[model samples]
Target: MKKSFLILVVLLISGMMSAQNGGNDMKKFESQLPQEGRGNVRVAYQGKAIDQMIYEFMEEQGIPGMTLAIVQAPYIPRIVGYGVTDIEKGNLAAAKTLWPIGPISQGFTAVAIMQLYEKGKLDLNDPIGKYLKEIPEPWKSISILQLMQHSSGIADYREQKAFDVSANYQPEQLVQMVATLPLAFDAGTDVKQSATNFLLLTSIIEKVAKMPYHDFVKKHQIDYLGLKQTYFGEDIPNVKQEDVTTTANVHQTFKKDKDYINPSETTTGYVEKEGKLVVAPTISPTSLKGFADIWASAENVSHWDIGLAGSVLIEKPENRDIIYKPTKLANGKTVPAMAGWQFYNHKGLMDIKGNVSGHSAFLSRFTDASELVCVTLLANKEGVDLTNLGRKIAAAFDSSKMGTGANDDLLYTYESLFSVDETMSKIEKVLKTMGIPVFAKFDHGKNAEEVGLKLRPNQVIVFGSPKVGTALMQENPSISIELPLKISVWEDKNGSVWASFPQMNLMAAEYDMESNPVIGKMQELLEKIVIKAASQY
Candidate 1:
């Protein structure tokens, strides 16, 4: 019964792909695999097919192609589906099909860095430019933590407007993009996401290890883990055919974009569409959006393989029982694969360029449930909507009972949008809308008894001004209905207070974050609302 249900899920994803490309891209979804994905990742279920539910979702939704792999302990890793490779060709996708892993590739570099850390060759807190000297414009020191946490003020790769997608880049070229970028904020003071850090990290991996970045991972992790078929771009070799076969027939080469990859090249062949000259894939803002297609087979794809092949996971190896294990650190000490973000680790999407383009992907691990999931959506065209779909797949194991506990402030806040009366009435409504089953016995905090229940020093999702929406009045005054106001509620341990807020507001539809007037109003309204709510709310 579960197998049948799994097939249904794959078909849905494939169907979604067909709508956008107007091409018949077939998909394959697999569930259930050898227990301990490569050993430690057990498979819970497996499924695959052209019209499977997962594929159908992707196909009908206009997704070009996609792959889903999941694992539950003591079971074989599930190979969800490699939905269509091309919409026009009706090409089917298969498990183990190589798709560029995008940002999750960041995990590989991070691991390689950690391995170096174990060796004591480099410091995670070291300035990135120190490793790559040729970068043109230099910025202030950005600690490894800043890069890892996205706290560095460096402008993002996607934020730059002049970048060219088809242009190739050497690793040095990747470094140059941010060589001169002014720190977005002091390294630790702010948080902003950027791909430049990882690209630079890739370079650091090479500089410190002396071997190419991909080579170090292949020798140290993939090979040691016995993920014979798993490799990054062309650097991985010596794979068993069964381990890496994909029936997805997307052309290995395509109408190449001139700037697609210039400075840094991948193992995959990418030549100039206009000429035979070769260049490495250069990451540019244009290419970050990612291709619509993804590739990978279930053979080596499980959360376990992700743990071994990509970033550090399962910090407590002592917590797991696996038959095979990677080699000890150069110091002859076993390095613990420290876990991060207990329930959900992190997922990333990357565009194809060198070993990196035409592939959109994700990685997730439900640590407490001992479940892990990964999906790769590979195609020749770029798309940004891929994450919307990945999240749905991840939601399956997200364990709603756990409630994302990242910012406690967000979890406890009561003053979101809407009026006090309407908001209070809608608590049950909002909880129901969240999909996760929730029960909130409304206990208004009024008198002494009620006051005890209220958490003081609230988590306030604050904005600086109330004027952003006034300009929207120029476009339409009703916009005020969704005014850019602060959403804050306090929690007090004694009389002390704490603050927290939602990030979604920055990207919400009602507020145009890019527009200064809108942003200012939001800041004003958010602060005013937050202050008012905190004092009397």
Candidate 2:
């Protein structure tokens, strides 16, 4: 009876889960990932019993299905899918199940724009009108970066309730919706996670790449990353939710005796009614969804993958390719945010509630460990909870004794200016790294030519500390090995400035020197030393 009912009625799920049904999906992991062997990172797996915990938690709480991909330390990555992708048909969910991973793709859009920048096709500060035949208000003053970063005052498509129609939308229509609304604030003054910003990004990609946004996703990110499991979600056929009120096996757990299975594509926008699925979507043109090109089902789940592959890049120096910043919410609340957690920073959402959708997803490297990466794919879709899943995973790892660090050689890189600093940052992310708590002080000396600098220098600075060095050596004998630090400035072939600080390796290695007490003391002393040394008159 329940089987027939689930097939008839769709489910309106929440973020709650039983955890029990999840099985080995939860628990400690002790596997080896060797990224080099895998063309990215390689590894081996003794695969921990995470599945049992994941299942137990999910079944106990009611999360119907979940997919997990962990790049275990010292080995290759592992992916596991638990529960039903679709509860009605008893379709089993696999790691390959197509779900909407929202705004996190916006950064990819930014990258696409950068690709054009690399081709000398566009400038970062260029106005939107340069490419578009028509520019909206403030378009003349709005730079591309402003739009990419949501510093633009553009309102969002999901801000209004009616825009939640489950049908596909034309890209232009989305633009029209944005245009109808007034700007939330002037570009670059304030920030809101606006779908409108990404709409512009899509429009810009289409204008420059000469392809639709979806196609642009394919040509750049998906193909470049070889991401078989990720997508823009436009090509995945929609599962029309039948009811808005009925509740089925959403994130909530089901009766233990019930032998109900989840499906590959669960209904996201509606709920089950008297065992009948009812899709209660706002009236809108289905064509706006852009899913006319998609027809994915069980027979062809692998055939039509969505094509946006902009997420975390585990490799660094990334050659100045990745750009990110942290900001407090305008509401002025001092509490930690969706963007604050370590290894897992999120800005958008595609959950059961539909709060934020359609922007960026983030997975930052552990700055203190072995440069390991963690993530939460926050989408703009209303009422989805994948980001929550990431947070749970991060907590599990952070609090567990079984956790290990990455063993990449690059973890011991250099720190010069923002360029090299960023590289060193990537290498030391997971090793319990420390921030540049001490600012670098600069002393403008004579030009390199005037001072007899041998090579062509972008700039030069004389940096040292005779006093601090003596004090440190007296305080601790081992501290003498890393003294006498200096920074050199120059421009790369690209003409961008680079700074170099050579002592990161010495400090980083000290933190790993087996003895916990010494490492802690060294960190405390280094923090003070850097601050005192950089103090300027």
Among all candidates shown, the one with the greatest TM-score? 1
lDDT of 1 at 427: 35
lDDT of 2 at 195: 60
After TM-score superposition, the amount by which residue 457's alpha carbon in candidate 1 deviates from its true location, in angstroms, is 13
Error of 1 at 95 (Å): 1.3
RMSD, model 2, all Cα superposed? 19.2
lDDT of prediction 1: 0.42
**Could you give candidate 1's per-residue lDDT for residues 1-537 as a string of tens digits?**
999999998998877776754543221212343323234222111222223445544543344555566544434445544445434344445554555555544544555566677677887668776876765444436656456555556666645665555554454554556667677666555444566665666667788889876577677766665663355533323322221124353333223543222111112312223322233353433233211111234345453345643234324343222201221222343311211111111212111111344443445433333334444333332322343234344433342321222342222221222233333334334334433233223223443345565422232221222343455556666655544433433333322122224433443444554444444334433333333332211
lDDT tens string, model 2, 272-346? Answer: 345343433422323222211122221121111111112222123231223333322234422111111211122
CA shift at 350, candidate 2, in angstroms?
Answer: 17
Model 2 scores a C-alpha lDDT of 0.41
